[model samples]
Target: MTVGTIRPGGRTARVRAAVLEAAADALVEGGFDRLDLADVARRAGAGKTTVYRRWGTAAGLVADLLADMAEQSSPRTDLGSLLEDLRANARLVQRTLTDPRQGALFRAVIVAAAGDARAAEALHRFYAVRIAEWSSCVDDAVARGELPGGTDGAEVIRAVSAPLYYRLMISKEPIDEAAADRAAEAATAAARAGVFVRSAGAVE
Candidate 1:
């Protein structure tokens, strides 16, 4: 079974929740550089040895935290209009990147992924899950004839949030409602223009 597949009972589940919460706090407070297993255990009120035995390493703990986050993430919106659904997704991304605690945590994780292989893989997995969930919106769009029949749902989904992420990670600009709306509009227009249509032999 996968690391997150097990359904621990009662105390075990509580302990895991507490530990993961502490780990997120640590990341938000000081980033990945200061994420220590012992410190997280202390913050969680769990035994250091238990934390060490369960998670083994800071990177391992971070990976599990990301897995848990993926599980807890909100479901995709299903507004009938493709543009509306994309706008909802863009606004969700905008809100997350602009929120105080969530923004800090995301920045810390993103920074960690930049320098650590495990963190990078975990980050990729997280985005992959999110993209899959939101791709349904594009699928719906294709069914509604809003986009080309061969439109790549995943690509359309990625286009919606890519600009918001760029602002959060690269441009250091403000991620506001306007930015989110613009991103949604741009992606919707491109999708309508068949920009995300899958070509023959395209690796999906």
Candidate 2:
């Protein structure tokens, strides 16, 4: 099997779970620069050879961790109204970014992506999965005539979370409920005004 693949209900699966947990702890403590396979093995009570043979490198472990995260992420909420759905989405992002462990883990991964190509790809894939999941909310809105027929669901979803992430990663501002609500409102207004609609001349 490929790296990070888990066998069903077996020692292999247990080992994978343990290793991923240890990896997350390591990231939370020291960021991606200090993620070591042997250390992860020791922390997980698994064999060093197993960890090395399976993950090969820190980036490989990060990639696998992101895959697991994508698999385990929550499904989007549908609240009938577009604004309400987007507010829910933004609030979820706010909660995750404000959580002690999840926030630190995300910071480590974001920092890792800054200089590591493999980590960058993994990060991109993770967000892509999340965005697609929430994009359905926008799709439902368009169908209900709450948004323009050609509104880009994915972009609207991105807009809703963009400010929240900026606060988490750039401005060092608080990711409070008010901030989340503002993000959702701005994105909703823009989307309703047809800002997110794809035009024939728009660049893909």
Instruction: Give the per-residue lDDT of model 2 (tens digit) for 137-189.
Output: 99999999998888988899999999998998999999999999999999999
Residue-wise C-alpha lDDT for candidate 1, range 1-204, written one tens digit per residue: 012333567889988988988998999999999999999999989999999999998889989889898987889999899989999999999988898888888899999999999999999999999999999999988888888899998898899999998998999999999999999999999999989999999987
Off by over 4 Å in 2: 1-8, 201-204
Model 2 worst lDDT run, 10 consecutive residues: 1-10
Candidate 2 structure lDDT = 0.91
Q: After superposition, how far is residue 92 of candidate 1 from its true place, in Å?
A: 0.5
Backbone collision count in every prediction? 0, 0
Which residue pairs in model 2 clash with each other? none
Task: Give the TM-scores of the predictions, in the order they appear.
Answer: 0.94, 0.94
